[model samples]
Target chain A: MGGPGNAKIEVVLVDDDALVTRTLSFLFAGEDAFSVQLFNDPVAALRHLEQHPAHVVVADYLMPGMDGLQFLSKVRELHPESSRIVLTGYADKDAAIRAINEVGLYHFLEKPWRNEELLLVLRRAGERALLLAELARRTEDMAAFREKLFRALL
Target chain B: MTDAPGIPDPCRALFSAHADPAAVLDPARTIREQNAAARASFGEAAGRPCWAVHFGRETPCPPCRAGEVLQEGNALRWMMERADPAGPAAPPGVWEVTLVPVRDAAGRVTHLVELLRDVTLTLGLERHLIELARGLDLEIARRTAEAEQLAGRARELQAAIEQLREEQADLLRTERMAALGRIVAGVAHEIHTPLGAILSSLELVRARLAAGRTDGLNELIDLLQEASERIRKVVQTLRAFSRLDAAPVERVDLREGIESSLALLAHEMHPRVAVERAYGPLPKVRCRPDEVNQVFLNILRNGVQAIRGQGTITVRSFAEGGVAVIEIENTGPEIPEEDRERIFEAGFTTKPRGEGTGWGLAICRRIVREHGGEIEARSAPGRGATFRITLPIEGPL
Candidate 1:
């Protein structure tokens, strides 16, 4: 789990094609605020996410064993605070949009996407995930403090 | 018989001289006089009743014209059928009877002259003509029915040919649409992957430039050049594939066309399928270059789809005996015995519905035949399938 500014944003990128995943990882290499993990298979990515939680999970929409949406939906169950993003081709734009609305996904990035837009969107998603994690920690802290006060009163 | 009469000698002479059987009847319907012929025919009946002597009846026969002739004071004629007097065992004989009334000077009918002629021979001829006409009518009816049946069969054959034509057109359209879909999908992946690499590498270079770092600049440019070359090759091959308005026939290196097809379909066959090529020295063959490329593409795509997890596709080309021969073999499952021959037929497919149009090989066979070439498939149970195509060195004259 990542917190506010200056904390490293853990990013997990999943795609069946190695060329796609490799270039995406290179895109985030220069930014010190982001750390990216790459997986060529969606099933393997899901298995990795079980133990190593990510702040932002980026997935390609088309894969052989499991599609990006099914993988990301399972990611949501594993880590509700992790912001999800999907990569799609121009031909599947309509299906990707529907997936965004149906799965409550954060956003969809089209293939051959501009580097600047991709970086900006991932940056924002990471910040949002960090804020949600912070909020959840504060809520837990508040509950624990209330329980202590009630016990002291008893 | 001529001299014996109850009348004048002139009338008796005339009646006796007549060739036909003639009899004179009194007002009481009895025979009053008989000529020599009547005496011979009726056995000398002079006082017997006229009806009993002529018709062998107990009384006057029905449809008698005697009363009508007497009242009208004229002659009457009618047709009748009776036993043949010449041969009693023969069929009935027809007769025409004539009754003439004899009157006195006061204009009152007093007697009737009955004449009988042997007309059975003329009636027999008339009956034979009527029977021939009836037989002609039956023959005409049979011929008309036969003509109708032939026309019906011709119509059914025509309809069957029309349906086959429609099915052929439908298969052609479906095949064209399927080819277009495949081109769109494969082209998108081939171009988009390299373009993404080039752009992303450019972004990394810009970031390094902004940071004033000069290291690894050559590697970045190398990546850019490599990606650009790939795009350039894809475009060039695509241009070759789109030569729709070019010359219909050209002397082409068949190997180049095969390479172009393999380049366009590289994205679909990579990583899972290995391609091995063995090209022998060959002369240029005259063919439609674009159409030949399409054939290679379709066959290669089929080879790729046949293999499940991983397999190898082998392509070999050589020239022999004034012909160019190309063989493509894949290490996939063997084609069934029943489907080997029918695979080239239109609308025959093993792929599940919606995945194949079943006209790939059908189109291939047609295009080859158009160029005066031959295409065939061979396979055994354990061995894989191989498609062999041969084209004449010089196209159809």
Candidate 2:
């Protein structure tokens, strides 16, 4: 839960089926702690991601043109700090796990997923994304402070 | 001397008392003397050549035993066959002839005594025994040939039984594969999509109720109803399709079976191929609905695959003349003219290796034929390929 001072967790959901994306969008609704965007086309989603940064990206494994792995890999290149998750309808869990490891994705989810579990995973990924951003800001501030000290000593 | 005059003085009584037809021949083969029995059989043949008297020949009888006896200076015997000299109607007779060489005191062969006898009866019995043995040998050969023929038939029957066992095993395996193929395709898209929708929709309703807010409750309930209905229809179709083997026979609406098959294959057709159904009034056909459903699945799947990217599949059904008919047509590349009929042959495939078993169309034809139906393929160069199936309403006899 987020209060007025807390920032909303930004998320993007991608799937070829409009119904699936729509259903996922509803799952994140009425929650002040999360902000969700949906796409039925991986290419279109990639275009949107180039202009706007999302903290967490969730994609379906089976899409017509570009699959989840390819799309998530592209997302990684665009934003390394963003958490990438894959959703698969396949019955084989081993395959899903292998895909996650092969692509260095954040997590793997199955279709017809329990809502509570899905939310928990997405929340954790969002937290990680916020932590990485905060660490990068701290490192930049520390470097600037050290540069100032070196100038003063000279 | 008292019996006959001019006999040799050394053995005169012994030569005259011999009972068998006997004669004495000089070294030149001239008959020198004849005993009483010899004279009775030959009728004063003491001066005639012996071969002329017995065999009525111009030359000495071949292999003359008396001649050999004289040349070798030893006793010899032989069998001879000739016509009976008594009359023309008398049966041919055989004889055993013997020649005895007599030597003087100086060891010179002075004469040879020739002996003969009638042996026709003995030879006739021997010949009859040989004929009976030959007949028995022929009978044994015939019985051996008959036994071999029976064994050949037994071997053929055993081979037929082995072939039947193999075919039954193949049927069981292929049936399981068909079921698995349906499950994979349906589960991936049709049921899972609706299930995902239902689960999330229920969660939203539960959260709202827990929060004591009834604002969007009716809309969520509506979503739940729609999603569940779709799942129910898919489940019903699957259950009916799989239960066909247990039922054995059923009077079913042909259109409904075709619709169920289409439902199972809906995932393959979406977002790429367009499906058009031109169903007409059809009569209920008595058949094994499950097997018939498989036929539809094979054809529809084939239709989906034949299209390279985007195309239309048209399915038509109707009844005419107590026969239900279905025509499935695809707007894709036409099948080659030569492969129209051969596509239904077992082990015939156009797909790449490991992608096709070549049994799909073959099995389809078999199932259709088992229900007293006919299946055929037609294709023109530009129009595309069409499969036409017709089933008799009365069922197989």
Say which candidate scores most in TM-score.
Answer: 1
TM-scores for all candidates: the values are 0.73, 0.62
lDDT of each: 0.80, 0.79
| Candidate 2 residue spans exceeding 4 A from truth | A1-19, A30-37, A41-109, A119-154, B1-161, B184-189, B211-219, B239-247, B352-355
> What does candidate 1's lDDT look like per residue over B1-397, in tens digits?
4423334567767877888778888767788887777777777777888777776667786867888898888899987666534222223466577888877777788788888776788877777877888778878888888888889988999999999889878868778776876676667656776787788889888988999987666777777788788778878888777555467788888888888788776766766789999999889999998788788888888988887767889999999999999999988889988898798998799998856778899998988988899888888876788999899989883
Q: Which lDDT tens digits does candidate 1 get at residues A1-154?
A: 3348878888998977765665666676667888989898787899999999999998877565566778888999999899999875434444567678766799888767788898899899999999998998999999999999999999
- Residue A125 displacement in candidate 1 (angstroms): 8.3
Ten-residue stretch with the least lDDT total in model 2 chain B? B83-92
Binned by DockQ into CAPRI classes (incorrect, acceptable, medium, high), candidate 2 is acceptable
